[model samples]
Target chain A: MASYKELPKTAQIRLVSSHEEVYEPCDDSFALVDALLADRTKLLEHRPMLCMEIGCGSGYVITSLALILGQEGSGVNYIATDINPHAVRVTHETLEAHGVSAELIVTDIASGLEKRLAGLVDVMIVNPPYVPTPEDEVGAEGITASWAGGENGRSVIDRILPIADRLLSEKGWLYMVTLTANNPSEICLEMKKKGYASKIVVQRSTEEENLHIIKFWRDFDNEVDEINNQSTFMGSLLSQIPPFSFWRGNNGNDSDKNKC
Target chain B: MRLLTHNMLSSNIRGVVNGFPLRIEAGKVVEKNVEINGDFLKNMFVKIDWKAFVEASQSMGYTELPEEADSSMLDSDEFLNRFHHALLELHLEEGALVCPETGRRFPVSKGIPNMLLHEDEV
Candidate 1:
């Protein structure tokens, strides 16, 4: 007998429509979906009223999100935006195939709707253009927009962070995919400055690259870390610097400080 | 295009600000019956733009929806079914969405409205 209580699954490929110019669901996309699944319990409890996706590609991530949060959260509204018009059409067919739906827009990330949707999104997701390329290639036409990230793959990612911050509600949650080459820790540090707490929800190493799905949310207590950092910066550096063997022999509390 | 999709669409052409509620000139409208799910309809009510919805419905010859969404009608199964029929079942098969500011016509064919702007217009 089938289990009466089964976990929701991502949208099947049969339901995912495609086009030549659109980016299909790949390792990065699946990793993003996995991050969402890992956080599903918190998500359902969050009861997000509005969910938005930037750079939707073939609609895989948004569709997976909607399906994973199915009936219990039918009230959730989904809107997906892509710079590629072809992606918008493919997403339409994909959503229709699964008997689910979202408002599809073709434009730069949430361009026209920025004013209307400002600070209204409860959940936002992105598997951005993170492949290193020339700055000119970052937002190029058609398929190039799918994976062309210029100079450390931060061009598109940098533009998206501010927009995500502007669109996210006070309690909003954001999940984004980043490559190891993109410098994940520095990205986290940058978000820390913006008062967002982040963690690597999913990390996968494939032949091509190391992918990290980072989840960030508003941290009201972020200032606490800042205060602690100010007081402990020198102490932390002493623990990290050379002469560790001598310092350890001299200080009995070396292990205690190193624990951090 | 379903009214649900229509509600969120706005013209993004350069220099044309406030492209919402694009004027819909319906050439053809198709209505097909779909399963009635009360919960979905109830949830969609709050997210929907009542004024744009009412205007678009009236344009497609759907006069069942009231000028304003009534909270009292949510619990009624009959009203839920009606709302579902108007929103999910009705499709704008062929039409032209005229940009409010720029007066550009975006053609809707086979129930898909092309909102793609030209290179310079983007």
Candidate 2:
């Protein structure tokens, strides 16, 4: 069974849709929640925080975070928005059910952001469309807005970047998730061009996909030891494989092969 | 709406060549409790683009999905419950669906879609 956690006082409230139909929260949100909870010391120091969740569908992250924060004695104000009105309504219902309060809006991030929310965001979290291939487009209504990352899976992110820059506080943080398909390195480089330094804070690989969560911070240690260790181990293992084995001309040593 | 629907939607009502990526302008999004149909969901799993599904559902504020979903997990009650929630429950209420191409907006109210275009647009 899935368990719920309370968001800390210094933490920003999460906004997610509880309506299971139109919007279902992804696992990354849980991972993020867990990470934040694990690092409560750091998060709590940033008191009176405000967060904006772009493309908040059913209110999974926002609601969960709000409940968690309320329990943790932190007062968090969250603004969750989506282009779909239904998404916004569903999110509102979810928050109400949990006795958490959040401001929900239905608007296109590509067009612009709500004025009232301007320059008040301490953190901006986004999980934009990042599918890479044309063949990746599947379901109709869901896929249209969900995937279809324009030409290079950067369409939506590109549009959101400017808004994030504008909405974020001078020392605010941007937490976003993107796929390997989006070429995270390139995206991070682009963000640097916008005067922000970005780094991959977390990454996990599955059989079919590579998931990455990037954080753009004003000053953060980019040295990720765990990721580096994992990469090195994987590299060494691959090098030992038959395909990567050093090939010295088949020494006429048939007996040497059998001895091993 | 399914990702497939979004892919095929275009603003080509008449001369609008930018007919791709039809947005969901939901008005009355609802969650209904439906019987779990694992077989159907499992079969359709392959057809689904998991990333798109995750992103779409997450955008609506849901993030309870598994990182890597496999059809084999469909037999488990835990997996089925999540699948059922994601596949059958969410509904769009009222809003305008936009076309990524021509910047066309389709009005949606009371869970119904209004894809009609202007006479000249057609």
Candidate 3:
């Protein structure tokens, strides 16, 4: 277990731009970035060659990843995707404002990128649409795609998992945000079957939702003892670990005050 | 729209394959000074198609890059700076990203590419 070390700096909310239809940086975004910050030391040591963000609304999470991983002369390539053209536009503006650049694409999560990027991405991050809503509401043309997670909020999330598995390199690491209502344990189990070891980097409960930032990586040892390691991994993941409130005390910033 | 962005885009129109490395036809181009980051440029170099990048940069009126650069050149300060400049600073402010396979043109206005495809294409 790594100790929580404060980042040298995180993304400045004021520097993050917004659109009425695009989802702004809120608790989920902050917590996803917070998870990255908590694991920053490891990430810096990992020295990922390529980093990508799926559904990069406002480019907040990806920007924070760039800022968090932006060290002295480090070589990291960033690419972000979103279904909404408006979100892609906002993300482009936000990334420019922060002096970081990424290959921004407007698509459904890595749709056109499969052939080129398969098994090449070393670090992938997502703050997916995990809010459970009516099935029909999911994947709507506008801002609704940002949060309309239908049928246990797992629709978009489920779609992303297989794609992430395909894109992640042998040493890849994926950090994603999920709501408790989404049955995160089941998610972990599914990944474990794919031979990925998992850990909960950050778990926070706001006034409304219980959010979990889960990190998964390839582990051959765990795979060999699948039945045994799976149970233990599931036990520790769901029970032994304590969920901490990341936003408990800090009067963080303008981005922190934002909800939705 | 910088060359870096152009390098990752592809035409998503239905039935179109190999939409990668879109051909650039620029009506206007903008150059803004960005800090030269050697390490960043070196990493991007591996993934970007050198031929496509060189041709795109030339069409946009940038002629500093060589027709080919060996990895050894990554260590040269002069070469790295120019590589950094061409990739990051040169922007395709107004242009159309022409699909290599289908010949569809996605227009750029104010530096943002309009990638929205028609319903039939989707």
Candidate 4:
């Protein structure tokens, strides 16, 4: 059987460093990586020159991406940013242990990079602070900043969408994790207004939350940007997305939990 | 951070019209050898701000990159190697990226640049 070198590798949990204040890779993080794994073939073919991650907590998803795409002279560049300084250090250690590297930066939603990297990022991934909490809790110090997503868990996601639209090239693709409470359908409609198409790549539910890993790409074919048709578009998009029941594991279990 | 990262960063304080090419103040510079890919360098050539890249490299004590570069130089093996070194190899282990317009200093420690703006600037 094909094994070892023939299979793509991911960061080992044993080697992944952690800090008390940093958000460790959790269910959402695993769900995001699983989505990346599902789209591995397309990503390799995309051959993105620059791939970036916003809120790269514990470095799991970004490091996993580097490994999935291969490392030696693959010509892919990676950049990751986090608002938390401790998260940056932990991510650095995790990448080092895995023999992968990214230009790690401490920034709030790519603040300093917009002018230079405008319309340049080919691939962007974000597992934002998606847990609904008080608005004041959003962007708080330490681990709270990692999960205190304000009001419908969209304070951060709303901010990122515009930045992603501005930074992404015409061919750019974005992968993001969203919770049901975050009103993902509404988010997709928001992106449709920006002339991007969305697809649900993976859907999983835990006891506490149901997560959907959504992928978005600039769709010139989807030029139906008339504001009046948003409800109709949202209705059609929701229908096309497979119900969570259909995606449940063969034994009716959540497969993602095993990986965690 | 490497010069490549420096080339892609600016002091983004609010109302700052010009933040491109944040001047580098090198405190500690280190080099970590990495395999270079010619195709990647060629692709990056078109996107990089050449003047900013060269000056950032010079700040890190890398003077090999020519003051001017065009896609034509990609064919030269010598030029590619120098370009690769200056772009990816040299790291500003400890430094600050100073804003061109506001003159605000964003510190870089352990090769990670802190580019988050202060509340007033934001």
Candidate 5:
């Protein structure tokens, strides 16, 4: 049997703080962190200078990323933004509880930071509001802003794609969570036009939902004209992947730093 | 927020040009120790705007940073220490980041800046 020492370091569920108005960490959050964990080796080698999270909903994902990266001597910087003020505060407490820190801002996805962060971010992670809902429901207030994606769950995702493109450096990488309703394939083709090649890092399906964590990076080889011809093929290729992996509830137990 | 954040932030309000450095209104400043990494500091030096960074540190009541700096100065241990302190250690616990062009104030409460714009601003 694998001992506790073999377990990977991530944000402990007990250490993660929460607020009624803030979106609590759920399955989607777990999937995103698991993807990061699976890619931990590449991330360490990536040596990203600045890592950011667009919607740091309970701070679970960002905190997990920091722990996975082992921030002490790595000299990596973290920044997170959320539209809801309560989420930011809750995230702060979560980070504090874990002895990790990040610059948290209450903003509408990267607003007021575009010029300053443009082409500077090396790694950006997002668990966006990909849940489909009424258009008016999008950005309503509080927790609603956390999951209300208008019109086929593309409203917020659409807006963030352009901003992600602008802020990402030439070597930047983006990992985002998407629901099946959000049309992950079309999203990949859209990003392809902007010279980003994407691969699904994690795919999970449960009784009620299908989730995919997609990672995108600048691919100079994918020219604009070439993307037009490949769009249909790319769409089919992405859509055909079977959701074979079921996310195991690995975060069920509360484990502290000294457990090992 | 730290000066490194300040160095990267600008007044992104609509129709505002030349908002490279949002003027700092330091209300309450705090310093926390951060482990110094010379390689990180040296790499960041090329990307940082020295003039704006110096001005930011001065507003935070840290005047040790020189008015002008060059890459060669990064070799000095003293300069690196000051640079590290100014860049990462100092935090604006309670303050406001004023937009240079419109004089719009974005309040920084509990070290978290409220950068969300009103509907009109959007």
Candidate 6:
């Protein structure tokens, strides 16, 4: 296992700018590189793994993952993406400097994923924008999209959840990191509804805050339940038409009042 | 420069109004040598602001970029090579990104830019 203390200077930190500039530690990145490295032995056992790091700022974690994975001779392919071109440039530079190989894309998570990555990812990692305040815009550099999660700080995550549900493979795992301000229970519940089971893998308490890394796995058992429950009377009746067919084109449907 | 930081940046901090795009008044911009992973670049192409990228590159004296970029460009060695050099290789060691809106200057020294806002601006 690669020790965190032994990580190279580049892996330890990076200069990040979205609109403002700041020094970001590799550990401060949404996905922890050291943790990912430590998990490699177990990860490679499942060989030819495909990994993705979303919102990769300055290419810290993704480049680090590429370097480690490349050296291990494990067929680990990575896709690191961000919305800012500058970030893409920085990530590319980092990967080049480290001699690590991975695909880098510049795209927003809200616009759905690249078609090439569809249904092919084995592991997905995200360090989404979770800042809860609108006025808390300090240090929001070139990539405001990387930190702004909307009014409730859930807009970005909520938009990505549906896309994630479709992109992740049946046996794939998703690792996400966010601050305590977000409602963990609600996020897990949403994941559950999308046919995945989640667990908190890492939790840390700093001087004034708590941080969490949650891991989500596809629920195969739920697939069987869905299949078994498909033939029930209610299910059969619901299958023939759209769930909100009565409200099609505003047919005076007051059904929304009863939804909750 | 980070796009999020770029989005909030303006040159008119002194009293001007149209500081949408901050100009990079770099004295010395260096490009760190880094590798290029085509697959990752392809996926990321959709999210980048192409115009901003071109502008930044042009300001840095890279004038050979195509008028427009397409996904196919990711596979072009020439394009990738140039892009790699422009985006990843260039470093602004001594410069300032002047806000067009307020004319407030954010200085870049020793490869780092000070972006701390004033108490009143916050």
Highest-DockQ candidate: 4
Ranking by TM-score: 4, 5, 3, 1, 6, 2
Between prediction 1 and prediction 5, which has the larger DockQ? 5
Residue-level lDDT tens digits of model 6 in A92-175: 666666666455544455222333345657777787766454535412556555665544456677767776776676667777
The CAPRI category of model 2 is incorrect
DockQ-best of 2 and 6: 6
DockQ of each: 0.26, 0.02, 0.28, 0.79, 0.74, 0.03
Q: After superposition, how far is residue A137 of candidate 6 from its true place, in Å?
A: 7.2
lDDT of 1 by residue, A151-221 (tens): 77789899899889888988999999987667666676677678787777888876656678888898897
- Classified by CAPRI criteria, candidate 4 counts as medium
Count of backbone clashes, every candidate in sequence: 0, 60, 0, 1, 0, 60
The digit string of per-residue lDDT tens for model 4 on A10-124 reads 7778989999988888888988889998998999999888899999989999999988886538998899999999999999999999999999999998998987898888889
Flag clash pairs in model 1: none
Candidate 3 lDDT, A1-260, residue by residue in tens: 13433436666789888898899898899999989989989999998877999999998888888888873247676888888888988888888788877767667788766755777789999999877666887778878899878777789999999999998989999999987777888888899888898888988877766788999999977678998676677677779334433323214232322335
- After superposition on all CA atoms, how large is the RMSD of candidate 3? 6.1
RMSD to the native, candidate 5? 6.2
Among residues 3 or more apart in sequence or in different chains, the pairs in candidate 4 whose N, CA or C atoms overlap within 3 Å are B1-B111
Report per-candidate TM-score of chain A alone: 0.85, 0.68, 0.88, 0.89, 0.88, 0.71
Per-residue CA lDDT of model 4 for B1-122, tens digit only, reads 98888888877899998888899999999998988898889988998999988888888888888899888999999999999999888999998989999889999999999987778888
Point out the higher-scoring one by lDDT: 4 or 6.
4
lDDT of each: 0.76, 0.55, 0.80, 0.86, 0.86, 0.56
- Local lDDT at A216 for model 4: 97
The candidates, ranked best first by DockQ, are 4, 5, 3, 1, 6, 2
| CA deviation > 4 Å runs, candidate 3 | A1-7, A71-73, A96-99, A223-228, A240-259, B72-78
**Residue B55 miss distance in model 4 (angstroms):** 0.8
lDDT comparing candidate 3 with the true structure: 0.80
Tens-digit lDDT track of model 1 for B6-116: 776778788876788878889999986655656656756876788988888888889998787677799888788778877777888888888888899888866667666
